[model samples]
Target: MITFDQVTVRYEDTAEPVLRGVDLTVEEGELCLVVGHTGVGKSTLLGAVNGLVPHFTGGTLYGRVVVDGRDTADHPPRELADVVGVVGQDPLDGFVTDTVEEELAYSMEQLAVPPATMRKRVEETLDLLGLADLRHRALHELSGGQQQRVAIGSVLTAHPRVLVLDEPTSALDPTAAEEVLAAVTRLVHDLGVTVLLAEHRLERVVQYADRVIHLPGDGRVVSGTPAEVFRSSSIAPPIVELGRAVGWSPLPLSIRDARRAAAPLRAALSAAVPPPVRPVPGGDRPELLTARGVTVAYQGVPAVREVDLTLHGGEVTALMGRNGSGKSSLLWALQGSGPRKAGTVAVSSDGPKSKDPRKLSAAQARQLVGLVPQTPTDLLYLESVAQELDQADTESGVAADGVRARTILDRLAPGIPDTTHPRDLSEGQKLALVLAVQLTAAPRVLLLDEPTRGLDYRAKSELVRIVDGLAAEGRAVVISTHDVEFVARAADRVVVMAEGDVVADGPTTEVIVASPVFAPQTAKILSPLPYLTVAQVAATLPADETDPDS
Candidate 1:
């Protein structure tokens, strides 16, 4: 059990408190989910429970915060290790060991858990978190999702009564996020561990939480059951929105529930009108960027074998596969950040080979390509949002600073602020800001690595729309993402890479609907023909007069 009694936390020299007079309690065996827009102190709230706020961050604190019967001020992170376990958004930054099994056993070893007991715990954790298949993999060798599971598994090895996660699923795809959340839900149902998690993807976790906590940017705590809290707030899951539209009592909590409630309504609507069936888009045109017989190596081992692939302008293409499939490596090569040994990579736009990304001069390369890196904060160094955008605008030379940044931000607004500190924004907002700046550069081809990893459904949709619009403008858009829903909605083509080889390529619907490993959306699976949107489905249904059975 944990309690915050009028708790207020402020960082060093900061005038405003990140947490303002927070009074809340999380009881044993309860799962509490924290949701809010960017810069709402969700991460700060998690810090209070683990004593990382004033201790690690060095801030001013007011009022008493208690966890597991000990005052947070009295017990530091190390002292509270037995009572609380904390996992952060970035698994790479949190990795303490080289291998998966060692990382999982590190905490127990520190607790002086018996060697015999530690071994047993390690095995159990691997099994519980579905890491048995990857137990022998190197930390750097794992995928984003696998690395995240190992991070949480390392903390779970300590057997803390309370598990506090800050954006635990931020780096995961839908399937991976589902796996991590299912494991967390099992802890609450089977092990009775109290869970307090902060995340931007409310639709994925809100249904599982017993209570919901909202922290607006204004510094206040909004607490109640999920339906009660979300009903009063501006944010909630898609199912909740559908519930409001269909008048479902208590609100549909899960997609399964939503589907059930939709069946009758869909039947009634279908009786009146038949659903439309659209054809899949045409095959990709000529390649904008092509790799022929390409091979890459690292430390004497082959990372990418002889492979051939093409990216076309005015199309959205995705690179996907399991962990260690060489998806990221290929992207690096395309960005000219990696060595190319045995093949040639060519772009459609006219340029000298020396002006190519692989061997180009600085200015020449800047005129060719723009990349949104996987880590949102890695490229951001400005003090304020406005300055970051202004610098980007000036370097781009396409438009005036005031004109371009304002246009982009307004399009991406309700989530990002033009005047807020880039560091103070949520992970999703920070990514969007950097991406908006990247778009201003006006490159022929755009490379986005895991673009939707941390964003909520709304943010994800907005980003997809932006990419779609860009593709419509005839820019080659290559996105490396695991969000199947996003891929289904936006991609015109799909490329599958596995173990450094080009395994598959085709139209988006054909590739996703045909692949056995990559799961498509439920609606896409249910409908025989391609159906990406509800509006599309609404327009296709046949009229009631067409069918006598209706």
Candidate 2:
């Protein structure tokens, strides 16, 4: 269904092509997963499938890319719209209609399908994607996961032969990510629809993929079975890394398979103890931030009810919940930015605010707290990455000429081009840019909402270091994420919310390992061990036992 013959794409003002001499074929009804580091041309390759690369994106293409026997070189995205359906990382940015039902039917209308046929397809799509209940609801009213389903259904209604998705599950919680993946599996199994997509969260979708395509940072691509590709691939999920650590032959791609081979390793580490987590400095440590009676409402319906929370000077907190369970709303309210029907949020150093937090000026509130929203690009308005960093350094009053901010950005995601536009960077790179911009201000409390949405394994490691470094410096870090693995490594404490209330809050191990759904893969594999991360498990085992060549 898709073929790339010696394809090479070179964008303007760049010395080297993003893709060099790539040759591959994806058969009909097969799901091909493309994996690569951040900004390493995975998007460039997917864009080439529908002629969005050289045609719409202004790049030079050297070879042919064919979809459904039609050369994309001759066909633009609009011309091939009936054959290829592309869903991007951000669903809200692509929405063209107000209601769910209307958006699903809009594509069919553009294709000039018969009115009866369009209506039938729209209903089927709504049911297929489990969006039947949201048909009449406004698109804006739905949560991030709901909007993703609608976006996919909108393209599916057109009855395209091939489906292309970019990081479909990045913004979703564990349950929501499962639902979306199951829907895609049905399309491939029940309808024989071909799928080509890219995702950074391999742990979420690797088991469902038919084949894996590994894109090394250099201009080389490896295409083969999952095990074959992941053998030497630099980026891999914890399960694969676990298999490597224990020297398991035929490395497992899923948690179930990994658990079966973990008997010895689990037993070996059973008697061992993980290093104690650094204390959050509570005895003499002052309360850096506090919230009481925090309630956020939209259209008279409370999204976050009266909740009290506290953050210490030195600690990492994980705010976790299902989608639309008031995670994002609470973060904004605590930052004194988003709407708060009733609440009191104040920074201790601000000297006891007699007035409401919502009444503070934008500048004053920003100094007390800074938030990196779900869509990091929203905080960036400047034209280029360099301009954004320079402006941030100036506003931060750091007396550095873009030196400090640039240093942070480089550490977060190395080698991001200075002249590149903020909108032009990949989802992961955009996240790094916004994070750097906010950190320059050095707010007392830092809140990151879905920070690892598009980061590869290596990039996430860099983020882990950044988060740890911030906490070590006595800054409060609260991260809202669905990545259990990351939460296991980064957060010192866990706070779970459900239906606008705090359901559970305690130490990381006590809060995360106690629950089944919130536990990380390593925790599941080595059950009853109180271990939450691969690093922790490796640390517990003696160096002589975990040989890769054993």
| Whole-model lDDT per candidate | 0.75, 0.86
TM-score of 1: 0.84
| Native-to-model Cα distance after best TM-score fit, residue 21 in candidate 2, in Å | 0.2
- The whole-model C-alpha lDDT of candidate 2 against the native structure comes to 0.86
Task: Mark the regions of model 2 whose C-alpha exceeds 4 Å error after superposition.
Answer: 276-283, 350-356, 400-403, 548-550
How many residue pairs clash in each candidate at the backbone level? Answer: 6, 0
Q: In model 1, where do residues sit more than 4 Å from their true spots?
A: 11-17, 133-137, 268-286, 297-305, 350-356, 381-390, 401-426, 501-504, 507-530, 534-550
Give each model a TM-score.
0.84, 0.96
lDDT of 1 by residue, 432-547 (tens): 78787888876778888887765656666677778877776677888887766567666777888777888888877678776544545335223344444444443454443122
- Clashing residue pairs, candidate 2? none
